[model samples]
Target: MLEAIDIHADALKRAALTAGPAARVPNCPKWTVHDLVAHIALVHCFAIGLAMNRPAKPAPPPDWEDLLGWWDGQRLALREALGQDPGSPAYSPYPGFDVTVGDWTRRMAHETAIHRLDAESALEEAPETRFSPEFANDGIDEFLTYLAPRLGRKTDIRVTTPERTWSLGEALAEVDGPADDVYRALWGRPHRASVTGDLAPVEAP
Candidate 1:
């Protein structure tokens, strides 16, 4: 989670420097660079607050110049919260998972990473999307366990990458690509062509 957070923070910082506040993010068409930064900052605050078992009071969004610093502080608090017992009770919007602080750490890591990619795409110079093999694999598992059930399809599913292969459900749908690309596709990004499967399209939660 810490590593993912570092990568996410760095990417957004670079985007802010290169694209400025007015650039449009292709993946998040409704938000400009500034809006994207503000959104993520608020997310960080919300996630950290939840992990700490704090009230869900919303924080005021920061200006562009202070955005990075605000995010840095939130990230630090989240890391501290996550360092506590993994089984510690926490509030998750997805209560079906009985999520804890540790789960929030992983969820926020991916959340930040994906949005980081969005920020980079706004600059028209997106870096290669990469995640540790383990992190990517775990993300896939989480999606299958928590998110896929909502698709209401019991079709067999196969997902493969250079590092590993995962067979899920009972139907014969298949998806194959680099781990990062597959992850993005599964998260409702427009990278579905990277995968070949009978899976129905599902929107990200």
Candidate 2:
């Protein structure tokens, strides 16, 4: 499992490097890929720190560029820490989320997976990268349940078609597809799902 974590982490690092720091990250319209990379790396450190009694408090980023090297180093540190103990008790954002190592590892894997797609979208390509169904589906669920809230979206974003994308924002449409398609639609991609319901773009949507 640690090996698996390494695989995703390495892939994420590659994506960040290839994508670079200043490239505008479309998923987070205001941020660049560097900001995306910085956000995750900082979160990784914050999670480990909070778990180790280093209390995290939100603060301004001096410049997102400052985090590029930090992300590179922290990615390695996180992998090492998780490799040594992926199931250790840890502090997380949710009040009840005293996550286990397995849980943390899964969380991190899912984190990298979805955000990598953000990078792909920033580069203006349909993301060809993916994960196993369990991880991808878990990510789908997590995105809807957790990350969606973070984006401050009001209603559930549903995908109707699995192949050719039907339109959203025209009216209430019945969209259906794989969970990943649903997830990407909600994440603001030009997704391959049909959408019904009130589909308003949210912060990261």
The per-model lDDT (C-alpha) reads 0.73, 0.59
Clashing pairs in 1: 155-171, 156-170, 156-171, 174-197
lDDT of 2 by residue, 84-153 (tens): 4655676555564455555666666666666777767666454586555455556655554555554455
Runs off by more than 4 Å, candidate 1: 147-156, 170-172, 190-193, 197-200, 203-205
CA deviation > 4 Å runs, candidate 2: 1-5, 51-54, 57-66, 84-87, 96-98, 124-127, 144-175, 199-205
lDDT of 1 by residue, 49-109 (tens): 7887784765645676677678678768777877788779887565454668777777777
Clashes counted in candidate 1 amount to 4
- TM-score result, candidate 2: 0.67
> What's model 2's lDDT at 185?
63
Q: What is the model-wide C-alpha lDDT for candidate 2?
A: 0.59
Give the range of the ten consecutive residues with the poorest summed lDDT in model 2: 161-170
Query: Root-mean-square deviation of each candidate, in angstroms?
Result: 2.9, 5.6
